[model samples]
Target: MYSWQNNEYEADGVTPKLSEAKRGPADPRLTQSNEDQLNVLLGAVVNYDKVIGDHTFNILAGVNRETIRNDNFSAFRRFFISNDIDYMFAGGDAEKDNGGAAWERARLNYFGRANYNYKGKYIAELLWRVDGSYMFPKDTRYGFFPGAMLGWVVSEEDFWKDNVPFVNYFKIRASYGQMGNDNVYYNDELQEYQYFSTYGFGTYIINDAMVKSLMESRVPNKFITWEVANNYNLGFDFQFMDGKFNAEIDLFKNSRESILWQRNASIPQSTGMSLPAENIGKVDNSGFDVSLGYRETFGELGFNVAINGGYAKNKIIFWDEAPGAPEWQKSTGRAINAGLYYNYAGVFRDQAEIDANTIDYSDITGNLRPGDMKYEDYDGDGKITPNDRVRRDMNNVPTFQGGINFGFNYKNFDLAILFQGATGAEQRVGTDESGAIGNFLLDFYENRWTLDNPSSEYPRITDRSDQYYSNNNTYWLRSSNYLRLKNVELGYNFSTTWLEKTGISSARIFLSGQNLLTWSKNKVLDPESSNALGHYYPQARIINSGIMVSF
Candidate 1:
């Protein structure tokens, strides 16, 4: 990089350099970062299959071993001799010392699976895995996980074919499985050996020579284990009208245990000592997915439509909460990633309303004035205080999200469109990095309450002048629900017979657009990222046309 800034002296017709050996006006810079990684993998597999009469069976077993090593180096320097020579060695002066690092990790695994079926009516599977990693102690370095699944084709029965002729097929499925996260810090002895007798060097002067000394970097916890998650799934699949229509729905629950927490939050700050991670928390998440589709060919034209939607919610099952905190302040059994917010009772209308109301937010913030916000006092202590602050159920995480897609083909031309949307989430908007605003938002300015516009929906322009609007409140939370046209494409395929003379077997030309439109209650930024801290970049709309040919 190179930049030149006109100095005060240069702008005033004087020499800018302060030293006799000063370099040219342009300040040249160079930076380099390099990474090298090597990996080795070895594995073996054995398979067996057999069929006798109406029964079938299959079995598979495998083992794998992997090793990885990585090295990284970075350096930066300035005051280059020439712009043509961009490397750091060409710099006239060194700005800092170069540094590099090296690290390694390895893992071993053994796995096996067995499957059986009776004709086409029933099926079952059994699986098991044993894994070992250098992140754990030798004695407890390995883990064993097993899982099983069963499925039945209820509509395949002979009786069903005779009783229900119109019904095509239906099947039910259920499965339970367990998995482990090797990267989670759930255990004190967690991760790729960051705690292993690591040492940092110190400098000392001995006999006029620089001497180096070593010291342990951190305390390591000896007892660590893998963070485990268990999952259960149940669902059904069905097809009717001779396979023209189909639908599938699945419900799932995932529970995670032995979650790594860096340190016990309840521990006193004075008692801290290079705290290591510990398995101190649990969480549960549950959700369901549904898909429905219809496909059919009417004469020479064919078309299909599909819609899919899903929702999920999670909660903190167990966590070490404070001893004497109120129920509202605790994290136990509450929604994950909940927001801190105060209740909104609309904007303060006027001084008469402020004097009549018992809610006082002055001590917490500065004096609350008319045209400012109003918050509810949950504790009802005659005045608003920390005790009055409450948690609003609004979370940035969406509980409902889905998409719909449809495509059709007529003759040699085709068209497709897709729409996506989400609801049940809140987006916080308005306000800059500093509590006191810099540039006012257009929305706040348009609806601001004034003496003449006392019925305005938004508080007055004084929002920049008071901390009352700075605190988290309903005034800042906006519904992020929105539906948008995500994608659209139109294409035409040339008849192969027509291109046969040209030596082209196939050809297609298409024009496509993405993020073309959106409908939302929150309009400042795209609802998808409306809750971000600062100004967020809205989704981009891209349009392109291209041709693909094959011979």
Candidate 2:
């Protein structure tokens, strides 16, 4: 496969006829960018099947190789001779910028599978694969994976049919598998061929003149290899009441080993060299997913309802810990991306309580005052320090998520509605206490701590420029749980008589909406945003109507 893309942007600053003297130059600009990508795949396969007596067998094998190449170039310029001419050649030579990059990736795999069945009631399968990648050293570039599965179809058995005719179909299956991953990055940039050292050239001032210097840009780690995941799953599916009701449930556990991560804890920054990532991390995740659905028809009306949900939680099994680090500050055994924060202990109500307190917080909040936020000293020390921070599970990664789908068809009219929600996530609220950005929210202003209110839920207002009350603590964390109307649609299809009269095979019209409504306790910002500080743009709501016809 091959693909290419091109983009161009041209702009000429506009100046009001009466305000030309008040405004500076127009600064016309133009930018052009293009990308080229190429992908190639080669594969061969063979299959064999045989039936002997009451037994059946199937075997298959294949080899695959894939490669990809991608390149991009961009150029920009400003200061055009005339705004009327929007070509790049019309712009001055100054402030010219251009950049280009190219990269290639490849992978190869050999796989095979075998299957056996007895009398169409029992089933078994075996699978194996060898994957190779260019990201690792030659000795560790390849990984071997194997998997197997067993299933029992209860509905196919004579005894099951005789005992429970109402329960139309049922099947139970279990499987285990392993896979490898070589996708890793350093400093937010993809690291390809991480086992080899790399260098780059840069200009430096020398002897009052610019000189080009060559320097090492990356250090290699030959021991770095692929990260592997061992996965186990058991699941079952069933239908009853002549297929009107159905459900599926699956339990899964995955253990990931040799995760690619940099050793920032064990290695010191004073080493004066950038170190390559190593495969030394491990984590375990276990979860369950379930789905239930029902459908029935009454005369000319048919309707269906389905609901599905899943829950997953992961814990770090192994991670590099800074020597002498407190147990409360360790990342191991905690959920991935957990944060460290000062534990909120409520706000001081009066000056007497601040004077009675012995814990020193001068290093953190400068000075204590009435209505100021308070924190707990996790280490039991008299002074509050960074060591007092404790790991917290409050983050944007939701542990539970699900959706509800409902639809119905009545004669020529159909309607569908979907609702989605998530829980077990949190985001901190941002506020401008000094009204620099605008007036404070009425909810915060009415409930703020003051001499008259003395509310413990909120602290007293302060200048936005002051960092006095700015601290990462549970007080700022708010549950990100929310339920939203994801989508709804209504459509009407013309009858056959009407379509035939119009000389058309089919015709329909539909009205649909997306992200129409949301309910959440975090009223300040959208709960679905992943930023710890809710600063991203909220999801857009849309309503559309369209007609369709086929002739």
Candidate 3:
């Protein structure tokens, strides 16, 4: 059994104008203040097990609880003069308080497995688990996920007796199972809100409030169901060449249903709501994996090498949008991380071509003429607008990801090295959204258009007049696809025989380095940062040396 608990608190206040109000210590009247956040969590887990002749059974249960409290205080001072030549003084104070506690998410699981061997030639196993989560409704909170696998050793058969000199070990296996994830946040049963107010002379009144206003439907059918995923896998393992070479290949497909997503629902202005949470989509992911290993020994030196690679593709199988929306609005073919941009046509030639053609440059603001990107008019209306923006021709998935490792051993010393990389992912290079305001230094600002470089990739750095034309261009869009050295570590191990002479069973000293190097075409920042190219805390490169001993 295990148990844990934690608690935290914080307080803050500010009086900006107090120091400036007077030559001496400023008056405490004109000030703003707030105190927030008290949070706590507690949880426990317990396990039970039973053993049979050729099988093992186990059960595990756990519960988690949490609570939070928030409070704020604000005040303003004002002077009021009476008409009777007498001065009257008054003040008001405003305060808001909120607290929430939930006792939820108790989970119970039972697992059982049976293992048997018949003359060590054939092997079989069966396993099953029943899991429950508090986030689901009472009726559907529990489900059984079962899996079974069978393995056969062809070399163990009597037919291989005469071929024993050439045949070693060969096995085939297959499995299928179901898994669940519950990442839902907050309580669904109640509506939560935060209060704000202002203090005035003699009276404090509510100024404003915010609430998680969601449009709920009355067609309640499994509203809080679990997000379920089913997976099927098949593979084969082989060992030959005197056990010096081995390999395995696995193929799998996963189908997920009842996925929880934020569906855009139109709410009446009377309710002042715009969005709601609903289970309205389904997705599928499929992939294949291959691994190979080889080892050989020559005289006093030994060499070993391994390579692993995998590829996966994901697609939205089902999705629905609000009624009365356009077909494009209802379309959900791409993942959330997919990039949306205007297809780039070569720069226009001149103003005569711009005026001779009935092209609408609504999407292209600022100056009009040739030498700018000519976007494909999707609607064929002889004009370019927001409707012309479509999905760019780029990869939405990683083409391939994998790693390779090599090791060498001589006498009591061993050394190892690894190389890893990922390729074929599209990323947006520039800030396309105009309304957002924040940091921009991390963006590529070195190639701004100027008089000296009039034909620069970017537009002229004029005022807001041509802001629209300057906003969208190929100069800002760059291919995010890149291959990088993900990580690397090299280590050497000492012989245990030397440690045994010092009254120790084993001892070793090693040195390692991580994120040591990268090779890619990405120019602005580290290509491996994130899909959304933006400024973030720089990752650090680490190197260390350590020793381990056993007695």
Candidate 4:
């Protein structure tokens, strides 16, 4: 059995005090406030066993309990200002201003498995488990997660005894199970206090004929629900050549139902609320995985290699109507996981060419001119509209990704090399094309429009900048594909005999380096690294050396 407890507190008193002449006797402005939190947990486990003939079965059970408390207090008066007016004020301090909340829960789990052997040639085992969490509503919080697998050794079977001479080991196995998450935000069911106020009349005696008015608002969404996910997987494992080579492959599909998402509909303005949490969307993912390993020895030289790779496709399954959404918005389409702006074609060569092209170049913005990028009238309606926009060729997900490693051992020395890379990705580039061509602090300024640089790639500077430099779909996208050398290391392990003489079990030394090299066509500081489009934090290469010892 085990138990634990924790406590925390916070206090604040920095706001300026109100003068007696300007303060109202009935106001509840908090000059000081305090808050505290406390939590405790207890847990225990028990086990049992049973035996019959040559087989045995075991069972295990566990229980856990937790409690939490929160306390808040206003030592003095409190007041909130709204619309430049002290409209709402409640009188309370010390005991009258204090509030507290508490919650408790319990969880239990059970597990069982059995092992048996028949005729020494065949072996089998069975396993199962059930787990529960208390984060859900009392009626829905508990769930059972059970798993089972079966295994068989073909070499032990007489079917392949004479024909297969080199094959030494073989096995076939399978399993299925269900799992759940109760990770919802704490206090999601409480409509807690939020600070806001509105304009109102001052405290003053008035005639019965006089009229006054005030405004009030309430918070929304007193409770929220939890999200759940389900998954299924199947795979196989194989080994041969005296266990020198092995491989495994798996295929899986997962679905996230009732996912928690913020509703996009506008809330009543009188309540000053905009978004609320709801469990209303669904997402699905499917993928395959493969892994291979091999080891061989030739005289005093040894070789080892390993390879692993996987790919997955994701899509949105469902979403209800989004209130106040535009007509262009629709349900059951691939989620907008990523986007890329259209490329900007250079301007028309001249006015005759622009007119001959049947296009209007006047509405173009920011450093644009008659010789900038050419625009295609996608709709063929003789007008430039959103219909003319084109999608980029590359999708956001990396099409191919993997790594390779090689190692060699000779005498008392060793050498190793590793390589990894990723390909087929894209990112948006952030550039400055807004400032005056000659006066702006832009990197492209040094190469602006000029007779010597007349064929410059960037647009020319002019007073009608807004007309040429608009932030359209054409100016904010770029490809982010790249391949990089992730890491490298070389180490030598001393012979065990040498360490044994000194009463030590083992000892060794080595050196290593990371992010040591890269190869790519990306133009930015480092195309391989980006927090997000337009925001990048450069990473530095590193190297180090170290030693290990066991005694």
Highest lDDT against the true fold, candidate: 2
TM-score of 1: 0.80
- Candidates in order have lDDT scores of 0.79, 0.85, 0.59, 0.56
**Model 4 collision count:** 23
Candidate 2: stretches off by over 4 Å: 1-40, 47-57, 67-104, 117-120, 200-210, 215-219, 298-301, 349-353, 369-371, 409-415, 431-454, 461-468, 489-513, 533-537, 540-551
Candidate 4 on 172-192: residue-level lDDT in tens? 655555555545332465322
lDDT of 3 by residue, 427-456 (tens): 545453222233343333454434454342
lDDT of 1 by residue, 1-551 (tens): 33334453455577553423455555777778999999999999999999999899999999999999999999888777788898778876655557899988899999999999997779899988898877766766788888889999889998988998677988888898888766744446434553354677887889999777887765676676666788999999989899889999999999999876665567666764545556677999899999999999998899999999999988899877667666776667667767666777777788888788776677776666778777777777777766666665647888889999999999999999999999988878756543344466666667778778885256766444356666477777888899999999999999998999999999999999999999988866678994555466758999999999999
**Where is model 3 poorest over a 10-residue stretch in terms of lDDT?**
191-200
Error of 3 at 282 (Å): 1.5
| Top TM-score hit | 2
Question: With candidate 3 superimposed using the best TM-score fit, by how many Å does residue 487's alpha carbon deviate from the native?
Answer: 5.5
What does candidate 1 score in Cα RMSD to the true structure? 6.0
Better of 3 and 4 by TM-score: 3
Q: Tell me how far the alpha carbon of residue 64 in candidate 1 is from the true structure, in angstroms, after superposition.
A: 2.5
Task: Evaluate model 4: give its TM-score.
Answer: 0.65
List candidate 4 stretches off by more than 4 Å. 1-35, 49-58, 70-156, 160-167, 182-225, 263-275, 320-336, 340-400, 432-480, 492-511, 525-528, 533-537, 545-551
Each candidate's clash count: 1, 0, 5, 23
- Model 3 misplacement above 4 A: 1-92, 95-121, 131-133, 160-167, 185-224, 262-278, 322-333, 346-358, 363-373, 392-399, 410-415, 432-443, 460-480, 486-513, 531-533, 539-551
Q: How many backbone clashes does candidate 2 have?
A: 0
